[model samples]
Target: MPHSLSWGARSIFKNRYEFKVRICYLVGEGRDLNFWTDPWHPDGPVDSQTSIGTMLSNIPRNVSVHDIRSDSDWKEVLNSGPYGELTQIVHSGLFTKELPSYPLVPWYSSLWFPGHLPRHCPVVWQAIQSRLSTKDRLFFLGSQRDSTCSLCRSEPETHHHLFLACSYSSWVWRFILLRFGYRRKPNNGLQKEEEWLRKTFKGKGQIARAIRIAFSATVSHLWKERNRRVFEEKSTHKQQTLKDILDIIKFKTLYLKLQDIPSEKNIRISNILGLPCFSKEKSSRHCTWDPPPEDMAKLNSDASLANDQGSIGGLIRGSTSNIMVMFSWNKAPETISELELEAILEGVKLARSMDIRKLWIETDSMNALQIITGKCNCPWRKKVTLKLLQDLLTSFEMWKVSHQWREANQPADYLSKHDCPLKGIKILPTTA
Candidate 1:
C-alpha cells in the first residue's frame, strides 16, 4: 500500500525530494503506487519481503535490504542496508568531482587568490557588465570635450589610451622595458598587452609572478596618474611611474620569498619596515653614549637641559671613582628640546669614541635620565634619542645612568661655560 510506505521511503528520497514524493502520494488520494514497474524501474520502489525468492530476486547484487522506522533507526539500515554500497559509491564520485586541481591554477591566480581574488573577481564581473552596457566605445571614455587624451587628442579618455596607446604611455612603457632589460615595444591595444602578458609568462614561475605583480601595480599606478593629471592639474612623469612598478615588483617578490621561510619572519618584517640591517659599526646616530668595556672600568657622561635652548649640563665619571669627563652649554634650542637632546647625544658619542667600558653617567636633567632608564614619559622629540640609547645599552659591557643635583655637577657645568665661547675641548683636572 502506498508503495510500501514506511521509513524505508527515506532510502528512496531525502529532504525536499522526500517531501515532494509524500506530496505526490497525497495528490494521488493515498492510492497504492507501484514505482518499480517499467516506467520507474530505474529508481526502483521500496522493497517488500512477501516471498523469499521474490525478495531475493528484487535485491540488487552486493546489497542488503533492511527496514527503518525512524531517522535514527535509518543508521542501522544505512550501515548494512541494500543501498549502503550505492550511497558510498555516490559519495566517492561526488568527492572526486569536487576536488580542486591545485596544480592547474594560473600563476597570477595563485598569487592573488588568497586575499585579493575573493574581493576582486566579483568586482571585475560587475565592471565587465557595466562596461558592456555603456554607450561609449571605450569602456571608461567620458563624453565631455576636454575628456580627451592629453598626448593623443583624437581619442576619448580610456584606460588603454592613458596606459598603452598614448605617447606618454609609450614613453613609460619604454622606460620600464629598458630598466628591466626588455626590448619589446609598448602594445597599442589593452587586449594586445593582455595577450603579451599571457605569452611572456607562459611556463616561467618566478618571471610570471613578477610580471603579474608588475602588471597589476602598473594598472593601479597608471589610473592614479591619470586621475592626478585630470583632477589635480598635475603632470605625470614616465620614469617615476615605471620606477614605482619596479619597486612594487621587487618588494612583493622579496615578501613572498620571505613568507616561505618561517624562521626569517622577524628579519623580513624588519626589512619591510626599513629597519637598519644589524651590524657592529659600534657607532650610530641614535646612541647617546658608547657601550662599556670588558675591564669594568670606564667613564660615561650625559648632558641634558630643561629647555634645549636654555642651558645644557652633563657629568662623566668612572664606574668606581668621582672624576672623569663633564661639560655643559647654554646653546638655545633650535626647535623645542633639540639643544638638550644634542647635549646628551654628544656626551654618549664621546663615551663611544673613548672606548669607555663600565661607565657611570650623571645628568642634571631628571627627565632625560628617566627617559634613558625608561622610568618616565618621553617627549616627542626624544623618540629617536630613546631608541639610540637602547641600542647603545646592548653594545656596552656595563653601564649606569644616575640623577644628580645641578650643584653637585659644578665642574662639568664650569667646563661648559668656558667651552661655549672658544668651542674648545677641555680635560677635567684630576681632583685626587
Candidate 2:
C-alpha cells in the first residue's frame, strides 16, 4: 500500500485476487489465526461481513480464533456467534474450491519475448495493463488540471486515445508499420493493437524480434515525450520521436546475429538498419569460385528446400576444375542446415571413395559450414551427422572447409534445384 513501492512489488500487489484464491486456512486449534482478519472460514475473511460497531463491541480486533473456542467444539462456538451460519460451512469442508481464481493473461508472451529491451519493458507492460498514469487516470484521481493529450492537445489522454486515436501517436505507429512492411493500418484501440501485434509477430525469428523492439521503443518514447510535455514543458517533433525509436531499434538489433542465410524480409530489414546478415567478416559480393591446388580435389555442395521438402546436390571437381562426380538425392523434409550438412557429407564420401588424398569443401550455408568446422554449436538433432562427417574427413591427408556465395556455387546450385530425382527413380550416378 506504500506509494514508494517498486513496479515489481506493485504488480504482485495488483494480482492479489489471483494469489488470494490459492490460500485457505485450516484452523488447527486456531492458535495462530486472527479471529477477524484471517480467512479461516470456507467463505472468506469474517470481518468482510461484520459491521464496524459489531466488531468494536463483540471482540477485540487482535483476538485469536483459539481464544473464542476455548477448548469447546466449533459448533458450540459458532452457535453463540451472530446468526450461526458458520456451523454448516465448517461441517462441510474448508476447501479452496469455492474461491475464484484468475485466468492467465494471453499477452504475457508478447510482452516478454526473447531479446526484449529491459528498460523499455516496464513502460510497455504498464501500457498493456492500463496502469500508466495517463492524464485521464490522473483526472479521475483528482490530480490533473487537464485530461487532454499533451502531444496532440485534442483527445483525452487515455491509453486508447494516446496510443492509437491521437493524431501524433497514430502517425508514429503508421510510420513504424510501413517500416516493418505491414500494409494494414493500426487497430482502433490500444487493446486491439496489442492483440494484433501478438497474433502477427508470434515467433523467435529476426523479423519478430524487430517488430517487438519497435513496439516497446515506441511506447517508452511516447510516454517519455508525454512526461516531458507535462513536467518539463518541452516537446519533440513526432518525426524526431520516430527517428529515436528507429535508432534504439538499430542499436538493440546489433546484438542479434542473423541466420546463416537470412530470409528476404530479414535481409531487407538488415539492410535498412545496416546489420550484417552474414556471420562472416567478408562480404559475399566479392566471393568467387577458385580452383584448388593441383594436388587437391574440391567438392562444392548445395541444398534446396521448398515447403519442407528438399534435395541435396554436389559435384566433386579435380584441381583442374574437371568434374569427377555429380550427385543429387531427394530427401524428406528437414531443416535446411541439416540438408546442407548432408550434402557436404555425401560430397566428402564421394571424394573419399575416389581415393582423393587432399580435398577442399565449399558450401553456400554458413551455418552448416560453421557446424562442420566447429565454429558454432551444432543442433542436437544434427550432432550425429556432424560427428560422422568429422570422422570421415580424417581419412583425407589434408582437408579444408570454406563458405562460398551461391553465385559462385552455380553447378551445385543448379543440380540441387533441377536434378532431384523422384522417390522411386533408380537413377545412376554421373561421373566424368
Candidate 3:
C-alpha cells in the first residue's frame, strides 16, 4: 500500500500515529505481547501504561503474558495484589474480547415529499407555530403600537384572534367553509381549526391536493391582507379578498392536474365558488411521474427542514402508479442533507417491509443522490450519511436510487412539508 501511493498520500498516512484506543481486546494465547503497552485490559491502562522507573520495581518493561505464570501457587505470585485480576480472569478462561465498534445511530427516519406540498408551506408552518409577527407579539417586544386586530380592530391581535376570532376574518372563514361544504360552524379557537385542516387535507391523493392548497392559500392570503392593512394603509373588501384567495387556490390546484377527486366534491366547490372547472396543466415531457416496470415498485422520497427542525416523507407506487405506501416523520435534525439521506433510507425500509424485491428509488436531492450513487466523492463530514447509504444499497438485490425532478415528485414533496398526524412509520389511509 505504501509503495503504490503518491507522495502526498504516503505522507498523509506516514504520520497517522493516532489509532483508536477506545477498544477492549480479548485475550488469546498471549505468546507475543507487551503487557504494559498493549490495550488488552478490560479497564484502561493506569498511568498511561508506561514502563515503571528503576526506583519503582524490577518488573521488566517487556514482561510477556506467560512470564507471570512462573509461580503457579495461588497464594504467592498469583495472589499478589497487582496481578490478582488477571489471575482470576485466566482461571476462569475469560480472556480478551474486543468490544464492537459503534454503528450508525438509528434515530433518523426519512420523510419523502414534493416541492409544493402545500403552496408556500414554510409560511403556513410558521402560522401554525405562532411564529408570525402579529401585533401583540410586536407590542410584547416593546413596539410603541396598538396591539389591535388589523381586520376587526376589536381585540388585541394575536395568532389565534387574527386567524380565528376576529369578526371580519370569521366571515371569510365561514364563506370558505361553506364553499368547502363544511356544515357545522368552526370550533371556537385556532387549535381546533388546525385539527380540521389536518383531517381534511392530509393524504397522498387528488382530494388531498385540493384541500391542502386551499388551506395553505387561506393562511397566506390572510397574512398578506393583514400586512397590507397595517403596513400599506390599504385593505381589500372581504369579497375581493375571497376572490384573491380562490384564484390562488385555483391556480395551485390546476397545476397539480388532479385526477382522482370525487365528482361531487368538484361540483360542490366549483358551484359554490362560481368558478370554471379546474384547469389541467400538461405534464412535462421530460419530467413527470413514471412507474417502475412490471413486477417492481418505485419509491420516491423527499425531506424538508423548517425552523431548525427536519422532516422526511416518501411515496411507494406500483408499476401502474397505484400507491402502495406513503410515509412521513418529524425529525429533530437541523440540516437538509441529513434529512434528505434519512428520507431515502426510510423509503428503502418501507419497500423492504412490503416484501417488494425489485425497486427504483427516486429523490429530488442532487447532493444526496450523488453521495448514494458514488457519482462524486463523499465529504469527510458526511461519513455518517455515507455509511447509511452503504447499508441501504446492500439491502436489495435489484434496486436503484436516482435524482428525479421535484416536478415529478409531488406526493412525496407534500408529505415532507406537511406534518403527518401519525407517528413513526405509517401506511396510508390508516383507520382512526
Candidate 4:
C-alpha cells in the first residue's frame, strides 16, 4: 500500500529470506505504524481499526511467520518474486489468488512448479490417462466389474496392473529388460519405475533415448495388444512382444547410426552391406554351397523399391531349370544405386552359398553389371560393387557378368516382389 514500495526497495530485498521479512513488516505496519505485541491482542496486531487488523490478530504468530505474511500479502509479494523461482512461495499459498478454483492443497506437494515434464511427457501422460479412462468406462458400460483387467480379464485393471503389475505386464517388462541386458524386476508404481529407468540408463550412450522409445513403444504396443485381446478375443504372446522390442531397437540403432555418417560413400556402403563402416575391421562369414556344372550355372538377380521397404532377391540355376542357390535380403536404402548394390551383393552371396565353381551372373541393373565385370567404373558405385566382386571371386572357380533386361529377370523379380519360394536347389541354405 506504501506506493507498492519502490523497485529499489524490492530489489534490495531480493534475497528470498530478506524479501519474506520485508513482506511481513509491510503487512503488519503499512507505512505509518508498527506491530503491537500486547495482551489484548495475543497475536501481533496490524493497524487498529481495519478488517486486516482483526485477521492479523487471529493468526497465531507462533505459526510460520512466512505463512502468515504470505496469507496477508498474497498477490503483491508473489508478483515481486521471480517468475519461475517462486515455487516455495507459491506452495506456501502466496500465489493462490492467481489460481482460483484450484484445490486448496497442492496435488503433488513435492513436485516443483513451472513443472517441466520430460519433453513430450505431458502428451504421453494424457494419452495414457485417456486410454485408462476409456477402459474404465467401457467396463462400466458392460455392467462388468470396473476393476477387471481388460486384456487378461483375470485381475483389476488399474494403470499399474495394465502397465506393470499384472501377469501380462510382467511378461512385457521381462521382454524389455532381457533385450536391454537389464535384470531388474518391474514395479507397479510410476515414480519407482521412472527412477529405475533413470538410474539404470545413466551415462549410457543413446541408451536413455532407446529406453524412452522402448517404453513408449511398449505402452503403445501393449495398449494395442490389450485392445486386440478385448475386442477380438485374440491372444498375444510374449515372444511376439520381444520381437517387437528388438525390431524397434534395431531400426532405431540403424537410423541413428546412419545419421552420423557424413560421406555418401559410407552411407551407401552401410545400406548395401548392412554393416557399419567402422565395423569393417570385424570378420564376416559367407555361405558356401556346391556349384552346378560349368555350362549350367546361371545366376539371376533383381532389385525392387517400395515406399515402405526394399529388397533384393537372387538365385543361381542350372540349364535344366533346377535352382542351385537363392538369396533374398531386405534393405533400407534411399537411392537407386544403393538398391542396385544390394542386389549385386545378393548375387555374390548366392554365388558363395552355391560354391559355384563356374558362374554366369546376370542382373537387370546394366550399370551394376558393367561395374562388376570391369567394363565401367562409376566412382560412386565402384567402392561397394568392387567389394562384392572381390568377395564373389574368393568362392567361384570362374565367373562372368551379363546384363539382362529387367523383364528377363522374372524369377528373381517375382521373388523380390512376392518372396516366391525357389525349388530344386540341392545345397543346404545358410543364414546371412
Candidate 5:
C-alpha cells in the first residue's frame, strides 16, 4: 500500500484475499499467522467455520496462533461457547489437503515440475494456451496494424509461427534440440510440437527433465527476443539466444539431483551440461530385528492414517526379544510423523509406568527422529509435546533413539494397522 509500490505490487495487494483462500499456512511458532482469519486449518478459516461469538468476544480479534498454544490459554475460551469446537480441530493437527483438483492436463508436468525456473512458466503457459499477444492475435483484435512475425518479418506472427515455424525461432529450437543430442527436425506447428513434446518428455528421468526445461526456456527467450525487436527495436544474434537457453538449462540442472541412467544419450547430455550423475547402489541386504542390551528395553513404534483418521501402535521388547507389551490407539487425524512421535511418546510413558529405566526407541519415520534429535525444525503445534517427550527421555538412566526401516519394523507397523477402538489405547496381551 506504500506510495512507492509498483502497480503490480498494488494489484497483488488488492487480490491478496483471493490468494489467501487458495493457500494454506503452517502455523510454525504461530508468531506470524492470524488465528481467526487465516486458512491454517484444513477446513478453512476459523471465523467462517464455527460460531465464536460469546466465547471469543472477550479475546481480541487479532489474536495470533501463538496466543492459543497452551491448555490454560484455551481453558478460558473453551469454557464459554462454541470455542471448544475449535480446540478439537487444533489438537488434531494442521495439514493441507489438496483443494479440489482439476482434470489431468497433458502439459501440466511439462510446465510445472520440481526445479522448473519460475520466470519461464508464464510465457510458456501463454504460448501453450495460444493466448500470447503475438502480432496475429493483436491484428485480429484490431490493436496492431501488421500481422507479420516480429522475429521473422516474412511470416504471419501466430502462436505457431512466432513460437515454432518462423525461421528465427526454428533455428533457436533446432539448436537446443541438437545440443540435447536430438538430430531430428522439430515439428512445424505449435500443436504438433506440443504433441511431440508430450510423447517424448513423458518421463521422470534426467534427460526428460532437461529437455522440458530447455523447451520452456527456449520458448520464453524467443518470445522475449520478439518483443525486444517489436518494441525496443533491439536484436541479439540467434547464437547468443541459443547460448542463453543452454545456460538456463545448465543452471537449472545444477540444483537437480541427477541420476546415472547409463545411456549413451544421457551421458552425452550430462557431459554437455557438466552435471554429475550419481550411481546409486541397489543392495539386496537383509534386514531383521536386533535385541537390546541385557539391561535395556527396546521400543518400536509406527503410525497409520486412513479415511481422515489416524492410529498409532508400539511394541516394547525386553533383551530376550519377548514382547513385554504392545499397544494400539486411534487418534484424531494427524500426519504420519506426528502420529509416530505420539506413539513413541505414549510407549515411553507406558515403559515409565512399568519402572523401566533404560530404554531404546526405534521408529520408521526419519522426520520424527530428526525433530526429536534437534536435527530439524519442529512444527509449532508439536513444541509442547516434544518438550514433554524430551523431559521423559531425560528421566531414563540410559536412552537412545534410532531409525529402523519399515521392513524391519513390521511388528509395529502391523499393530498400527490393526483394527482398534476409536477412543482409548488398546493394550494387547503378549501371547495374542
Candidate 6:
C-alpha cells in the first residue's frame, strides 16, 4: 500500500535470504524449547530417551526443557526405571552455571599494570581511552544541558580540558606538585602530560616509582572532584584534593611495588622472566610445621626419586591438627619437580572431597609454587597441573597453595620414601 501513490513499478528479489545458525533459546516460559528435539544437554541431544540406555516413551513431543517442577512432576514425566536415570544425568546440564558472556575491553592489560590501583584503574583506563562519560561525550550522546564545563564554563567539557586545561585542575596539580617540592608546572594538557609522565617514570630507582604513583593518583582524584561537582553539586578545596592524592598513592603503593615496567620505552612488549635458582644449599633450615585454621585443612606434599623411580606422597590434616588422610602415587621416572606437582594434584583432589570448606596446600618445591602463581612461566612444566589447580581454586570457596620450606613438611617427606601406593586419595578416620 503506497499512500504517496508515486511509485510506478518495482522489482525485488523473488526469494528471501537463508541462514543456518542454530538459535540458543534461553529457557524462559518453558513453552518454546522442545525437550527431545533441542540440543540443550551439555553432552548431547536426548532424543528417543534411548541414548543413555533407557527404554522409555510417552513424554509429550512438545514437552519443555524445564518440564520437571516437583518430585511428583518429575516422576510423572520420567519413568521410574531406565528413563529416570537418563533424565537425572541431563538435568544437571540444564541448570549448569555459565561463564561470563561479555566482551572484554582492550585496555584491560594497561589497567592492571604495576603500581595501578585496583579500584581506580578501570576509571583511569576509561579516561585514558577518552571513553569516560565526560560532558562532551554525554552531550554528543544527546545530553542537552551537560555540554559545558561546570567549573570554568569557558569551553565545551571534554576529557582533555576537564583533566588538563581546566584552571581549577591546573591549580590542584600545581599545588600538589609544589607540596612534592616540584616548583615546576607539569605539562598542561592530558596527552602532553601523559606522554611526559610516561617518559619521566622511565628512569631507574625509587624517585621514578614515587613520581609515577603521585601522577596517577592526582589524575584519578581530580577526575573524582570534577565528577562530584558535576553530579553531586559539591566541590572539595584544592588542598583537600591534594591531601587525598597523597593518601591514595601511599595506600595503593603498599601492595604494588613490582618493578615490571621496562625503562627502554619498549615497555610491556615482552614479559621478562627472572633467572631460575640453580644453586643447591649444603645445609637446610630446621623449621617446624604450622597448622591451618580450625575450620580448614592443610595438605603437605612431596615427590622423591629412588632407584630410577619417582614416588609422590602427600598428607591431609583436619582442623584438629591430626592426620585425616595420607596418599602415595607411583609415577614413571620424571623430574622431581613434576612428581611434586603430581603429589599436589592428588592432595588438592583429596581436599575437595574431605567436607572441609577451606584448604591450605603446602609444597616444599618453590618451582611448583612459582609456576602455579603465574610469577614464572615455564613451558617445559606440566600445563595440565596448572590448569587443574586454577580450576580447583575457583571451584572451592577458599584455598591457598604456597611454598613451604622442606623443614616444615616432614610427614610428606617420610611418605615419599615409601615403596608403593595406589593412585587415589586414602579415605581414613582420625588416627595417631
Best candidate, lDDT: 5
User: What is the full ranking by TM-score, best candidate first?
Assistant: 5, 2, 3, 6, 4, 1
Tens-place lDDT per residue, model 3, 1-432, is: 559999998876776533335655555555565655665555444225344222224556787555545443232544544555552345654456466577642211101223254446666777767898899888999983799888987899888888757777777778877777776555466556766666665665444555555666677778889999998999889898888777765665554544444577766676665545553445555677878899989989889887776889988998888888988888876568768888887888778878888889888889888878778776776677678667766877788777799888889999898766546567765435
- Taken over the whole model, the C-alpha lDDT of each candidate is 0.49, 0.78, 0.70, 0.56, 0.81, 0.66
For every model shown, what is its TM-score relative to the native structure? 0.31, 0.47, 0.39, 0.32, 0.48, 0.36
Give candidate 4's error at residue 175 in angstroms. Answer: 2.4
Which regions of candidate 2 fall more than 4 Å away from where they truly are? 1-119, 133-158, 171-187, 191-218, 221-298, 304-310, 318-324, 332-337, 348-407, 418-432
Off by over 4 Å in 3: 1-119, 270-432
Candidate 6 lDDT tens digits, 51-121: 45244345666776667544323445454654554323334343321233688754343345566566776
lDDT over C-alpha atoms for residue 278 of model 2: 66
Please state the error at residue 182 of candidate 5 in Å. 2.1
**1-432, model 1: which lDDT tens digit per residue?**
355667766555546444443331211211233322211112223343233325335434333222221332333423554544321223222211121235542334523532232333442333322332212334335444455665445766555565566777677666655444467777656555655766765533334555555555655566566657656888657778777777766665653422222225434433543433242233333323333344544333333334333454455555344445665555554532354456666676667766765555666667667677777777776688777867776677777767655555555555544435424354564664
On a 0 to 100 scale, what is the lDDT of residue 200 in model 1?
62
Q: What TM value does model 1 have? A: 0.31
lDDT of 2 by residue, 77-191 (tens): 4555463555233443332224456898887776677778789888888898889999988999899978989999977889888876788988998998888777666657877
Give the per-residue lDDT of model 4 (tens digit) for 30-60: 2223333321121233344365545446545
Clashing pairs in 6: none
lDDT of 3: 0.70
Model 1 stretches with alpha carbons more than 4 Å out: 1-143, 150-154, 258-432
